[model samples]
Target: MGRPPGAGAEGTWESALAAHLAFRGAVLDVAGSTRRLSGELSRLGESHWGIAGKAAGLFVPHVEYGQSQLRWIDDELAAATRLAHAAAEVEDPDMQLALLRLAGPRLEAAMMGSMLLAVWFDFLNLTDATLSRHLYSVETLYVKMERWQKMLEPSMSALASLEPEQVESAAEDMPALVGHLTREFASLLDTIHKGAKVLETALVLKESMEALTMLSALRFSLPAMRPALPATLGVGLMVGPNGVMMGTRIVVSAEWVEMMRQLVRAGVLSLPAVSAAVRIQAGHVMMAQGHGDLPRGVRDALGDAPEVRAMRVTGKSGAGMAEPPRHHVMPNEFREWFEKRGFTGKMRIDWFCVTLQQPHHQAIHGGGNWKLGRKWRGEWNQMIMKALRDAEVGAGRMLTQNEILKIVAGYMKLYDIPMNFVRCRGK
Candidate 1:
């Protein structure tokens, strides 16, 4: 939160896909430049540069989140484009123009409110990345510091041997060289103390964010955000992997990503956004974004948890509609994968379940056309398979259910899938 919003170039979200990419490039450039500055620091050759650089790397998660949102939003932009083109056939020129703008404007509106999160997620280690969260932790700071000190040990020892054994060089009387070294050491300690304070304050803020998250986007930071559960699951970064993590500077929140999807789909495929756009009076400039004072229910309702999503789909419960199909939270296709893990004995895969509607199941799997389906469904499956396979192979053993779930939570966020499910955990 200490990092302010990014001062990106003057542009619109209409080019959201491109904007997202450009945002990533710009961040990477700055981060690269930041890392390169360590070269100047490296002249000292004591690895202090590494210690300070770790503090600067805290934004890695920000980059990851931004990139995660970018993948999902690419789909959004495609949907928006489809809608913009569709509007030309169904509506007048004025209406079409308004509809076209929705490609960027609707997403802009949805992503707008989430720009400033009321709650801060401190559960993560100095970064926003949920998966592969390998940043320089304070615990590791001390370890690196030792190496840094060792690098200078030989030189310092040499200096110590000549520390005026009795001030025989009194004629020169230039003050002991060790005194300057002591001052330098004090400076280093002060810097470390300040760094520790920053990390400590971050922890306190995490608690504060949790307590006040009543109005936050999704409760996933507290637990996880899931579509079918009483709660939700964590979504991945707005951008990531080789970029400066300017949190909320790029895509805002995953909550915004979902809403943006809904708004875009509504505008392109149907009437929700189209009708709303038509109603805007002439000489108007998207007055409804209302970011300055985002109403209470907006952020609170952004999550797509089972209850929240159900409530949004219909004003009330589905009294007569067919119940959603029940599916194992862990895919059935990967049963062998689970059995090899600790899923045997008390931990049965069937114990964890959720109701995934037929349409959604299809959407996630790219169940439709064979060719285009190859794009999303295949990649999604490959990612899940690769994660599990790689983790086990790397560790050279089966993974626990919780460990497996950690992997699941991350992929779900990247794909923007909800993590609602009923589960029974066991030893």
Candidate 2:
């Protein structure tokens, strides 16, 4: 197609809008992914390994990244629209070019503005959860110490009331009661100290996670796009009377790059600092209120009864004292159906890889793989029971990660065969 005069001045605004829309969609998807990942982490508990570990730490960062991107997109879109409208109103080529140049850095600033918001939102929930867990530990210590105080009050009262002859009997019991009280006090102090330490550790983790979040946001975002004047036929035609061809290179302003770099660095430093503060607050809360919030029965039992005390302290340190095992959610017929359909080997592995990497794409394949994995992991114990009930999968063999992957792949292949597969978007 032959170049139309002043075509660059006319179509630049339309092209900018299209590019911004594409960026907007991608940012929203990233935001959604962050949300989904956060929810998954919250559900999995702090103890669950793999993505859950990363998630516990990344929640704030994820939100921050998303928020930053979203804000940038919104601002960029608004500026682009205004510029387009302004361009529509302008008849002068020089004036239109001036408008484009002014809008360039503004668009870039809009794009980068989202980084702060992204960091703030990404890990907020995960950090909150960590704080909650720390506080819960402190509450436990408070309960222990409160019960000890109550027990000592009664002993102290009885010792004060005893008569001379009864003093002998009282004296004998006195040693035991004093010893019990001393032991209880020491135990309470120990628990308080331990809880404090845990709070400290959690604070550190939160700090580092926050720092990471900031770094990711600042370093990876788009910088401002500078407008460049076309340097070809126009300049040559203008200089024709002087018998000379002229050209100029469009250079993006140095200020724009420097501003972006600074913003990113500032975000990186600030996020960790904010997270550290949150952790410090949480730790203080945990240390001040150890075990105070536990059920009354549990508290009383800790101080008054030797058996209960042993169970609380000793059992806590032992392997048998752990929380009940979680169950999985896989079904009986799922494996059988897959085997019946001859789903195996490379096909299964390839699908598993795809589903793991591109969950959205797998969803289009009726997404049975993701659905099964979600069902299994969502409420683990129920899934285990269901698996146990099935003879083929249940036989003496426990489910492995590979088995789970296979099941997901098979389910995907079985139900999603007819759906057209769309390749994943973005690099």
Candidate 3:
């Protein structure tokens, strides 16, 4: 593909530059919201007692995680801004291509980080809802018992922070994070249930109808919050509003894609190869989050058709079994296909194939099952994916599958298998 006319035109480049800035602003917005939510949680902890007190403790770690992630996003955005500015100033096509190469991944990372922050925001909202209901019940019943409603005022202030925007901001974060928060909050809900029951039982000691009535209302109100909790904490973030897409597929912005295409056309990037490398990285991200199948749009963008399956070779005993199989077997056709497509030593494929083989002769004879070996391979694959993404940007092109293998093998010595044992047999 050749560079289109006016690819370096000021208007064309400025529009692309503007998109990066817009993405940065979105990320900053999410970061600001996170900071506010965390502050509110800390204030709530200071004022509340009983169920709210317990919840405040559970929320502490999550808030810290959100803040840390926000800092990382800020760093990425700053780097992207600098690169885009440099790219915009350069007249030389090669220099511009080089700048775009550096900027593309950073922008993509910022967008992804923003989406993650959005998910965390959702979790904070769910926490807020539970706190709100508890505070409301306390305020209502305290007045009936002749205790001043002003005594419950601190909790009311905490509830005020659960604005619609703050709650709605969490709609786009990662499903894995949402799923994790859901489980954590579900556990917290169980604690709340038990605490409420214990409080109800103790109220019987007073033997006053007023005390019992307060207890009844408290019990009823707390459980009412339970139904709302699941929608917000459990299922809401998972399926989202549409209840269809399992994970957020926030595609790389088109401006970034166009920039990459210009770089490729200018001989700064290897066509098809860089695209394959990027799609592979994206696939790994999805798979790590437990979505093994790529969305159709993503597949189309990568020029990967539905019929091309990434081969998965499992041992007959178990996929991650302790013992190595008597013989390691791979489909001959799969091997040929991989070689033909120049995917021979791609880190992901390499790790999969290498780990599937029986352990090194020393390990096998030394009574070591390939269990730990397999685990090591999995960890190394993840590291390699990160390395590959870095290499793609740094080199201004995709690393060949063999090149990726060498890089990963240097870091982790897990690929030290003899060639004879790797058998490619026909079905």
Q: By lDDT, who's the top model here?
A: 3
Would you list the clashing residue pairs of candidate 3? 119-173, 122-170
> Which lDDT values do the candidates have, in the order given?
0.35, 0.31, 0.37
Scored by lDDT, model 2 comes in at 0.31
Rank ordering of all candidates by lDDT, starting from the highest: 3, 1, 2
In model 2, how large is the Cα lDDT of residue 30? 35
TM-score of predicted structure 3 = 0.35
lDDT score for residue 74 of model 2:
56
Q: Which residue runs of candidate 1 sit more than 4 Å off their true CA positions?
A: 1-317, 367-380, 423-427
How high is each candidate's TM-score? 0.25, 0.22, 0.35
Clashes of each: 27, 33, 2
How much RMSD separates candidate 2 from the native structure? Answer: 30.3
The 10-residue segment of model 2 with minimum total lDDT is: 229-238
Instruction: Please provide, for model 2 over 139-254, each residue's C-alpha lDDT reduced to its tens digit, 9 standing for 90 to 100.
Output: 34334434544543342333222211122233233323333433443343234334444556645533533443321121111121122211001111111111111112211122
**True-structure lDDT of candidate 1:** 0.35
Over 4 Å off, model 2: 1-76, 81-93, 102-105, 122-126, 135-427
Clashes in predicted model 2: 33
